[model samples]
Target: MTSSTSSSSAPEPIWAVLGASGFIGSSLQAVLARAGITVRFVKAPRLSARSTDPAGILAEAAELHDIRQDLAGDLAGADVVINAAGLATPAGADSPELRGANALLPVVVADAADAAGARRFLHLSSAAVQGHRPVLDESTDVEPFSAYSRSKALGEAALGARKAGACPVTCLRATSVQGAARQTTASLVRIASTPLASVAGRGDSPSAVSSVDALCAFVLAAGRYPGEVPAVILQPWEGATVASVLLAAGGRKPLRLPGWLCRAGLKAGYALSGLLGERLHGTLRRVEMMWFGQRQEPGWAEATANVPEPRVEQVLRAARQQR
Candidate 1:
C-alpha cells in the first residue's frame, strides 16, 4: 500500500515495507490501504508474488546491492521504511541461510533507508530476544539461546548501531502473534475443530500474543510516532496465557500433562532433533518460547489510544470475518 490522503492538519506518510508478501507485511499493507495510505512492496526475489501486489508497486531484490538498486525509488519516496522481512520457524529455520537472512537483512534495510532519506525505520523484532525474563521491558538485557532468538537480538543491535544515521529507528518487539493466517491462530482453530484434542504440556506460561489488527495498529503508530519515542517498544498490555487464549477461542480444556513430564519431553525432543538432524513436531525455539512466560509492563508508550488491547476473541472473530 505508498501514498495517503493528507489533510491540512496531518499529512499522510509513504511506507516502504520490506517482506511485503509475508504475514505481518501483508497485514500492515491492508491496514494502511484501508486508511488511504500508499504502500510500496519491497520484495525479495525468492518470495515475490505478483498476486501480493494490490498496489501494483513492486520493487524486487535478493541481495543487499539488489535491494538498494531495485527499491531506490521506493525508499527515496517513503516516509517510513518497515523491515518486516525475516525467516522464522514457519518460513524455514533449518539452515545457516535463514539465520543469515534474519540476522543481517535488517541491517542492510536500515542502511538503505538511511541513504534513501527515509524519516523513520521500524524493524519487527521478537520478544524471545529477552530469553526467559519473567517480566520483559525495554531495559532487559537480551539473553538469546536459540539461533532464531540470537538473530533477532543481533538484528535489533544492528539497528541500534545505526541510530545516529539519517533516519531515526525503532524495533517493535511483538509477542507471539495471532489472528488470520498466523500459526497460533491456525493451531487454535485446529484444536477447536477437533472433538477431542490432545493439547500437550501444562500451559501455565503466558502467551503474550498480539492480535494481527492490534499489532498492525501499533506498528503504524510507531512509524508515525514522534522523535521522543524510544528505540525499543514492547506490545501494550499484559497479554493472555496460552490456556486462557485457547479456552477463549472456544476450544475445550486440553487433557493436561504433568508440568515436569512436559518439560522433560520438550527437552529430550529438542535435543534429539539437534543431535540426529531430524524433523520434530516443534522446534526448540518454539518449545522454549511456549514454556517461558512473557510478561511485560502494562502500558506501551508506542501504542496510540486507538490501539485496542489485543484479545483472543478478536483473533477468533477475525478468522471468522476473513472466512
Candidate 2:
C-alpha cells in the first residue's frame, strides 16, 4: 500500500496504528489506504527482528517506531489511535517481551492518545477473554486462560480506568481472526495444507470467525460510532469453523483426524519446538488451544450490519500473493 500526504481541505484524520506490521496491522494499512485514510504506523523495534524476511522487516520498519523507551512522545499528532499490538504465546511458555506488550501496551496507548489529544482510542483485544463458554456477548465476564489472555484483560482494565473523561476508548474483542498467514495462523494453514488436518474428532460447535477485512471494517466503524461507554466488543458471525474456512478457501478433499489424535499431534509438535529452541512448529499448539480450549462464540451482526460486506476472496488472494 502507498502512503501520501493528507489533503488540506479533507484534513485526513491522522491515524496512529501500533503493530502496523502484524497480520492485522498490515491488512489495516492496505484497507485504510483503499478507504483514502492517511495513517502513520508505530511498532516496537525489538519485535521487528523476529520477521522471517528482510524485505518484509524493512518494509514494516519504515512506518514503525521503537516504542520501548518513549511511547507518548512518538504519538504526537494522531487524531485516532489503534493499538493492534499483542502476543500469541503457547500455553506454558512465558515470554517477557510478549507479556509486556500485551499487558502494558494499553496503558501506553491510552497515555499516548491523551498526550496527542486524539479523539478516540481503539484497543484490539481477543475473544479468548470469554473463556470456555458456549456463547459470548458484550456482557460476558472475562476469564482468561493463558498469559496472553490475562495480559489482554489487564490492559483492557488499564485503558478503561485511564479513559474516565478524556478521549473515548473502545476495546474490541475479536474472534478467531483469519487472513494473511502469519506466525499465529501460519501453522494452522500449513497443517491444513498437509493431507492429515481434519475435523473428525474436533467439536462441531458453531464458532465465531472474522476475516481480515471484517476486522478492519469493525475498527473503522467503532472509531466513528458515537457512544458513551469506554469499551465495545467486536464479535463476528458464528458457525465459522476451521473446517468451513478451509473449504471456503478451496481445499479439495480435507482429512478428518480424531480429536484425540489432533491434540496428541499438537502436544508432540510443541515438545519438539521447545527441544529445538525455535518457534516454527509451536504455532500448531497455539491454534489447537484456541480451537478447543475456548468455547465462546461472539455475535457480530450488530456491529457489522451497517458495514460493507468484506471481500473474503480478495483477502485470500492477498494471502496467496504474500506466499
Candidate 3:
C-alpha cells in the first residue's frame, strides 16, 4: 500500500512526467524511482516550481517552447505520460498564467502524448472541482464555485474530450494535498510558526485530505491500472476536518467564528472586493472550501489498487517538524 509496485510481471514502464519539479511532480518522480520505474521529465519553462532544478533520477529532461509540438518521435518509447503540471495556489487561478497551465496545458499534453504513441495518459486534478459539498465520490457532479476549481474542471473536461482512438486517459481527482513541498503545507508551516494564530469558523467542518504519499500511490496505480477507467476521488476511509488538521499542524487552537457568521463575512468580503475593484485571490473561495468541504471515499482505487489509509496526521506532523 505504501509503495506503488505492481505485482504483475509486466516490464517496468517508461514514464514521461511533465512539470517534474512541482510538489506533486517532484514527489511522483521519487516514488516512481523507488518503484524502479524508468522515468524522465519534460520540464516546461513555464511549469517548474523552483527557479533552479534539483538533482534527480530523470533519464532526460527537455525545455519545450510549446507543449503541443511534435513529441511523437522523441517519446515513442514512453509507455505513459503524466500531466502533473498545474497551478496549485489561489492566486494562480486569477493570474493570466492559469489559462496555459490549468486549461490549455493538459489538453495539449494529451494530444501530444497520444501522438507520441504513449499507451496511457494520467492527469492530476483536484477535488476542488466539487467546490463545497457534503459527501463526495467519483460520480458526484462537480460544482466549482471559484476560479481555481473552475479551471480544474475545465482541464478535466478538455482531457475528457480527446479523440476516442487516442491513448487511454484517466483523471486522478485528489483532495486537499499535504506534503513538505506543497503550498498548503508551506502555508500551514508559516501559520504554525506564528506565535499567535486564529482559525476561522467553528473549526469542525469536514475536509477531505490526501497525503502526498497517498496521492502518489494513486498516480502509480493509475499507470498500471488494468480495469475500466474510473473516477477515483482519493481520500482516507475515515474523515478529518479543517480544525483538526490545523490544530495538528500548529498545536494551538485557532480563534473560532460561528459557522453562519463566517459565511456571511465571506459574502460581505466578496462584495467589498468587487466594490473596491480588489481581488482576494480566491481567499474567499478557500474559506468556503474549508467551511463547506466534502467527505469522499476512495472507492475504485481502494478496491482495485489497494490504496492505503492516508496518514493525514502524519503528514501534518511532518510539516510541523519542518517548521
Candidate 4:
C-alpha cells in the first residue's frame, strides 16, 4: 500500500530525521524517497544496548539545558528537522534513561533545529499523552498516568514552553499506528485472529488507528505546508473501525462484548492496577480504547486536504500476512 503524493506547487524541503533506523522512522524515510525528497539521516546511539559511555550519552542528551549537545552543525543543510527518535516502548520499565529519551530529548533537538536555521522541527509524540481519556485533540488537556505517558507529556510541555521561532516546532501525537515492522501490530492481529478476542459496544467504536503510510503522508504534507499547522496535531484518522480492522486482519468478526461486561472488566482492571502498575494498566487502557475509542480533531486532515487518501485496508492486510 503506497501513496503517490507528489506536488510541483510547493518546493520540497530537505529533511533531517533522527532515529532513522527505528520502525516509524525507517518507514518514513522510504516514503520520503518515494516522493523524491532529499533527506539527512541522524541516527542516535541506542540507549538500550550495553554501552561503554552510557553516562556520556546521557549527559549529551538534554538532561538539562546547559548540557544539551549542540547539533546545529549536523542539521545545517536541512530545511525541516523531523525528530523520530525516542523510546518507542512506552510500557517498558521506568528509569532516567526512559524519561530522558521521551521527555528531554526533544528540548535539545528543538534548540538545535532553531540554531541550524531550519524552518520546522517536527517531534513525534504519542496519543498516550492523553492516556485513557475518552476524547482527545491538540487543544484537549493532557491526562498522563503511566510513567511513559507522563514522560511524553513532559516533552510536549517542555517544547511548548519555548518562545516562538522562525523555525517553528510541531509535535505530532500519533495514534495506534500499525505496520509490518511492528511486532505489537502483529501480536494484536494474532489475538484478533483467535476466537477469544471480543470487542465492546458491538465493536462499532473508532479504531483510533492510522497506518504508518498514512502517518508518513501526513508528515510529508504537513512538513512542507505553505501555511501554519497547529503546535500539536493528532494523527489523522482514516475511517477504520475496530470491528472492520479486526475482520480485515483475521478474516472474521471479533465477538461482541456487551456494555455491562465491559464496565465490569474495566472496574476489575482498575482495581488490579494498584498492584500491577504498568502491566495491568496497559491492558486496561487497551480495553478502554476498544470500548470508547478516542475522538480527535479533524483539522489536521483538512489542513492537508490534497494529500493522498490513506489505504487502511491494505495496512490490515499486511498485518494479517505478517501475523
Candidate 2 least-lDDT 10 residues: 48-57
TM-score of each: 0.77, 0.71, 0.79, 0.87
Q: Quickly count the clashes in candidate 3.
A: 3
Each model's Cα RMSD: 6.8, 7.8, 7.5, 5.2
Ten-residue stretch with the least lDDT total in model 1 = 51-60
lDDT of 1 at 130: 84
User: TM-score order of candidates, best first?
Assistant: 4, 3, 1, 2
Segments in model 4 whose C-alpha atoms lie over 4 Å from true places: 1-12, 45-69, 303-308
Candidate that would win on lDDT: 4
lDDT score, candidate 1, position 191: 56
Residue pairs clashing in model 1 are 1-38, 1-39, 2-38, 2-39, 3-38
lDDT of 4 by residue, 1-323 (tens): 12233556776557899888788988998888787776688755333212113243334443444333447777887888999999876566666677677766776788888888998899999989887677767774798867778778877877786656678899988888888778767876787789856777778777786688888988888887878878988887778787877787677888888878988988887887767766677667766765656666676756658344776768878878866
Off by over 4 Å in 2: 1-3, 6-8, 43-70, 90-92, 181-183, 200-204, 228-230, 253-323
lDDT of 1: 0.65
Q: How does model 1 score by TM-score?
A: 0.77
> With candidate 1 superimposed using the best TM-score fit, by how many Å does residue 17's alpha carbon deviate from the native?
1.3
> What's the distance in Å from true for residue 98, model 2?
2.4
Q: Quick one: ranking by lDDT, best first?
A: 4, 3, 1, 2
Residue-by-residue lDDT tens digits, candidate 1, 1-323: 33334344665567888887888888888888776567877764332222111122112222347656555555888888988888766323345454445555666676678889988888889887786677778763798655566667766765565436768777888877777787666765665445533334666566675687788888877777665557888866435665555555554564555667766877787677767544543355454444444667654553445355566567765664554
lDDT of 2: 0.60
